[model samples]
Target: MMSVPNLDQLDANALRALAAQLVGELEQRDRVLDETRQVVAKQAHDIQFKETHIRKLTHEIAILRRYRFGKKSEQLGGEQGLLLEDAVDADIAAIEQELINLGGQPSEQKAVSQPKRQALPPELPRIQVRHEPHSTTCTCGCQMQRIGQDITEKLDYTPGVFSVEQHIRGKWACRQCETLTQAPMPAQVIDKGIATSGLLAHVLVAKYTDHLPLYRQEQIFARSGVRVPRSTLAEWVGVCGVRLQPLVDALREAILNEPVVHADETPVQVLQPGSKKTHRAYLWAYAPGVFQDLRAVVYDFTDGRSGAHARAFLGGWRGELICDDYGGYKACFEQGIAEVGCMAHARRKFYELHQSGKSLIAEQALKSIGQLYEIEALSADLCAAQRQQLREQQAKPIAQTLHAWMMAHRIKVPGGTGIARALDYSLKRWAALTRYLGDGRLPIDNNWIENQIRPIALGRKNWLFAGSQRAGRRAAAVMSLIQSAKINSHDPYAYLKDVLARLPTHPNNRIEELLPHKWQPSAA
Candidate 1:
């Protein structure tokens, strides 16, 4: 509010004072500008973070759309399909982690602070609303007579609801006879454990079939007001596996007796005894009859992928063995087993070459392979002898043509390219791949068996690793039964529950009847 003298009219002292004041004002402005820049920088960082997240979500959605609605597997072919699959996998993992975080603090916990209502499950038993009088009397001051009232529903929350089942065995007493008679307690899967058959089945299905790890199940039980621990759930599983061992034995026997079987293996991480680190264990799947035979599959858990493991389980059994190019089956084949190669494996090689934009040699091979499949397609309903004849008439020529084409192109393509690899693969496996043409009983590929073992693959992603070698074998047993049950069109949970209930009482001599193919659900 004070006026300043002009520099030209004032003395040096006044001018010097004004100059110092102006310098102070400039420094204050600089400080304010610095503060503003810091705030802007912080805001810019947050915006960048939000933009990156948005871009990620958008990319994930686009990938999901493409995988769901875009060109299918055959069109996308080999590598391209894998890329899309990986993208979808990343999105799914992100969602799973988000779900895990969400599950940590459930909505029930927040109800104390904010009592927001939600829809109760329709299956829950409900209590009718308690009516209250709106007024003591009508306008005439007379007692109001009873009339129809409107009803409304509101969700009520009960964190956990459970009941204690009182298993009171009937006891008969006669004072005159001075004697007492009581029925013996029924046997359970766990001799001393309090879990029922239904509970055992629920736990088994949750962990193995549904891929819910025991820890997650433990959390679920806590939320449901039960204080079951992961260790206890795991013990139940192990005990159930032991009780079901006889059925697994029967399944293996039935599988080994079959004339044709498909075999495949997948890696599993398992902790070996005396070793702190885990080792890569293999789950060897032997499907007795996938396509035309029985739906039963037996899995052998081995510590290594050696040829000896296949030979050991197979036990010198002579039959047709269909598998991939894994040389581990060489011993089995050498032991008088008819080696059948998967045409699907050969086809996939060519598919990869085509996807790589390599020579048309791969496409030509695929076309020839497709012709063979087309013939098999037409003969789907034919019996074995008829299918054999049909294959000899039509499929034989396709295999022969594909073989000749491979021999011719093997020299043309570069030695290390995809086309060259495909040609070499088909040519090397020419005998085994064409063996399917000899027997209609043989499947075109090991894909069906692969489907059976896919549960183990998906489950491994959730469970991460097995605790021990014995634990891995137990897992194999459950997986074998579950997959066999699935292929036989039986509800796995019901089958397991029934088997667990009856296994203890059922005679070991009649255990074969409890197999997936032969088992009948006992009446409640």
Candidate 2:
């Protein structure tokens, strides 16, 4: 600190200079103080943000715990209830992971202890893995004696069988070395991975194909005498999804090669980043036309149901597209892609009208649609030319009559009425709806693709919503292979197991061979 000069000892110039210096020092101090306040304010804001995040997490934990352990959970029944339980388990684990990331401990509860697990089956085959010290000599120049060994049995599952691995680690004394040595464990698919490829494949098949969530799989595995954590299972899924992407890409290319394709999209919910809220997303599915020899489907996942996504996926491929009346597909049509509208969508409008109340017009429309379907059923097994010829000879007249009836009825009903709306839908797109009559390669409706979309709809019920966009795309890729395998009559588990084991070393150039339609299982 500087000492204050006395006014009597200072000249006028000295006094002015001292005053200027004092003002500069005061200004410097004020700037420092202002910076300090700004820093403090920023820190306070961060603390409040973290505190609010923690509170939100804590609240979510409470709600999930109540759902998991409360009476409301007890009241749930049937297959859906079991699926809900699995979803809850996964959600709880996910939130706990988030809390751990935030440097917070997961909340613990003491109520409702679970029942004891049963023993493994005695019939399952057991494999022995031995662990012994690298050396038996002691550091004191004396040989160590053999000691009793400790064995632990872990339950493992393959596709259709349960097996056990007995790990035997021998205890060796080393008085001279003053340390114990053991054989190093072998490498696995993942570091310290608890599952083998077989088990990983099984878990994946169950989750993506059977619609069994990881939480449910955890319960199933626990009952089998091993309780794998859902988080671990999720890690396995992530790894496998990355590994299998090459094959999914090959499948998509194969689908695009066909002259005619079926395309459809379904809405899915995705958890928004850094928030508890979810946003709407889409899973776009593409497959070869019904007449195409390729038995495969590929899925593209996007965050929104936009036309651009469809254009991007089906880029430059101007094949015939059999789809619904979604305006998103209009851009594709404008690009010179042929459109084959779904007849079932038109039939559905009248079907709904008929179901709601008796309507003579609606009944007549259904009868006409039913006749057209009968003609399609008769030509189901015929060749393309023959089918098209048959449609032209028989179904075209019925369709024309239906068109005339709709046109005549349009003037009778008010524009806003359900019947009028149904008639208008069929009338506006009549040409595209009946395009199948000219080309037998084109499907009569979008039902074939709708069938492909069913698995996703069913899966949504159990998995609830995708955890992230990456997770959603991963699911879409895996399910594409699974569904395609089913389409070709291949068992999903066996196919996945073989593919997972081979994917690590399979040549990328020949990746197409692994697609479901061409895949041949490796010899045992």
Candidate 3:
């Protein structure tokens, strides 16, 4: 082979040009790698699925064989079923581990059984047990002195027992003056209410985070032999929402200050005043600065999915907004807010078309979108300036090429067809779609906000509908704190409990301390 190329021989411009060429080659290689990964993922999914089915059939076969020969079929079925499950889980675990070693994404549906490290809680009360032999005396018939003793600790649990706590103060009287005085009562989340801070925290977490409806919570309380009504719990939640407003306000301010924000909306069912029927409402979610370690998710509840809702939510703050092809957001762009389109949305349109039928145009569009995504995956870990430079060098060309192809194909496709619609959607949003090339901090998609909206969608499926508009507002306020805590990777229950316990006595001016981005456990 000839002598190896040396960087020292290359000048600055030459080195950059060479580097660009190498980056292009690497990008091509990455595209091939990603396609291979997708194929492997699909194959792995199929294999695991087939393996699970085979195991099930084998268990059934064993049971059938037992039934044909003897009377212990029921027992054999149970045993075989459990053994097969364990085998399936172990095999899948090995397969997943192998895929991980090979630097590929594993199929999400695979069942992997990994041992969980179980230990007693460090803070819970523990019990110690001591074991001693009855014959501890020396064999020579002499009494032995105890040298050392062994102790073991274990965790113990007992069913919850309810109790009532009452505060009583003694009255002092000055006989000459005939004056009586007593201590002032301490502040609380609910004044003179039977519920304590801990109980209120549980109710809020259960209702909003855990998706437990008030009626279900009432049933749970009854199972615990408590007689609290569902109405009482609802009142508690509404009160907490109102009290938590100061912190939520601080959260909104912090989020709105960020340079980049992601916004999305989902439909909600609400009962209108003086009307037996329900009206559709919307929950608008705004997430700020997802690139940072600490971020905030703010939810605004509105009566309709109009552009005014987004304008009101993002009042006077001008920055980049990543969203889909929704017409409601057109006004935001019109009002001078820079809009960045979601590549995922564009890809999804083509993905549906590809799945519905085989079309070279659709497949080529998917491939082009995939190339842009590969460039993004490569730049995920770089800083903003570097990432922007990389995008300019690598992603911009692909985007330009894809846009040209789309414009050319849009004219040839028949009107009103799915393929035509996909092409039109992409062509209409071309500027926003290519916005990420200039700003590295902005993602190619609004999946960040979309993810924040998923919980609300799931919640609606269970809670069914909001009692009224007021209830919808309360839900938004409470969900903001819970989801923000989740964004910061803090347990929602613990964060809510800490906030509720302190908000009673915490100063209103310092409510920012209770915001999820700034809040931390007292011990932490």
Best by lDDT: 2
Better of 1 and 3 by TM-score: 1
Candidate 1 or 3, higher lDDT? 3
lDDT of 2: 0.81
Runs with alpha carbons beyond 4 Å of true place in candidate 1 = 1-164, 272-276
In model 3, the Cα lDDT at residue 110 comes to 23
What order do you get sorting by TM-score, best first? Answer: 2, 1, 3
Q: Indicate whether candidate 1 or candidate 2 has the larger lDDT.
A: 2
In lDDT terms, how accurate is model 1?
A: 0.70
lDDT per residue for candidate 1 within 1-524, as digits (tens), equals 24666668978888888889888888999999999999999999977875665555445444443443445632233433332232232233333223233332111121122223333345545555233444534444454444334343332222244333334443334344334444455666666565667677777787778877666776787676556645456556766776776788889888888898889999988753223356798999988745556779888899999989988888958988889999998877777998889889989988887887965777878888899889988987888889899999888877777677778778777798777777888788888888878787877888888988888888888776665565677778888888889888998888887888787788889998889988788876
Residue 82, model 3, lDDT: 31
Candidate 1 — which pairs collide?
Answer: none
Rank order by lDDT, top first?
A: 2, 3, 1
Clashing pairs in 3: none
Worst 10 residues of 3 by lDDT: 150-159
Per-prediction TM-score to the true structure, in the order listed: 0.68, 0.69, 0.67
